[model samples]
Target: MSNDPLLDELRAHEEQVWDALVRGDADLDASLLCQSFLGVYGDGFADKSAHVGQLAEGATVQSYALTDLRARALGSDHAMLSYRARFMRHRRNQAEDMYVTSIWQRTEGGWINIFSQDTAAGEATD
Candidate 1:
């Protein structure tokens, strides 16, 4: 845990998203996202429904770990969280790493993820 409470809180929320993916809990995943949630991934873009729809068949991720967390408040009601995620897909032998940035906003119901982007970590250019 870090000294910043906002970072900790956002980290917890981010973990919940990974947990939902592992458990194939579409409802939980949907609940965490705002109705207008937007995700930019290497494949393309995904809205809230498309994000939760990935688990329709079952869990897609076997395991995951988050590190190098950083968070910044985007005012009082919104925050941006960035981290490195190492994870393996279900039934896959290899793991993949990606850098993720997520934006969350405070709402009457609680905090809801409003936006996110994932970038694959490729071999070092240098």
Candidate 2:
């Protein structure tokens, strides 16, 4: 990892978002997501609050982990991140391992996640 605090902050922001999702913390989700944030799911898109609102209802991430994380600074106020994630949703008895890309924008307060896209690493067939 570079000695760049901005990159560190960006990773922290990403972790916070996942943690908030797992914990179903609406306040944390609200704090981390931007007003213009967009979460691009495979089926469709969701705005910031509405997306987090789902988490607040009953969704909980059982375990979440990020690996192979790398970050690039796009100008001064924006950063891009790529990583592999492994997570489980206990309620659905579902698990996912995927590659994720996220874009973060700096705000007056701190770094906030503005966009996210993920692709699933499907199960192997033999």
What would the per-residue lDDT of candidate 1 be over residues 17-90, giving only the tens digit for each residue? 99999999999999999999999999999999999999999899999999999999999999999999999998
Q: lDDT of each structure?
A: 0.96, 0.84
Candidate with top TM-score is 1
Candidate 1 lands at a TM-score of: 0.97
Q: How accurate is candidate 1 locally (lDDT)?
A: 0.96
**Residues 27-86, model 2: lDDT tens digits:** 898898889999887778889877788875754788888888888999889899998899
Relative to the unseen true structure, what is the C-alpha lDDT of residue 68 in candidate 2, on a scale of 0 to 100?
82
Clashes of each: 0, 0
**Model 2 backbone overlap count:** 0
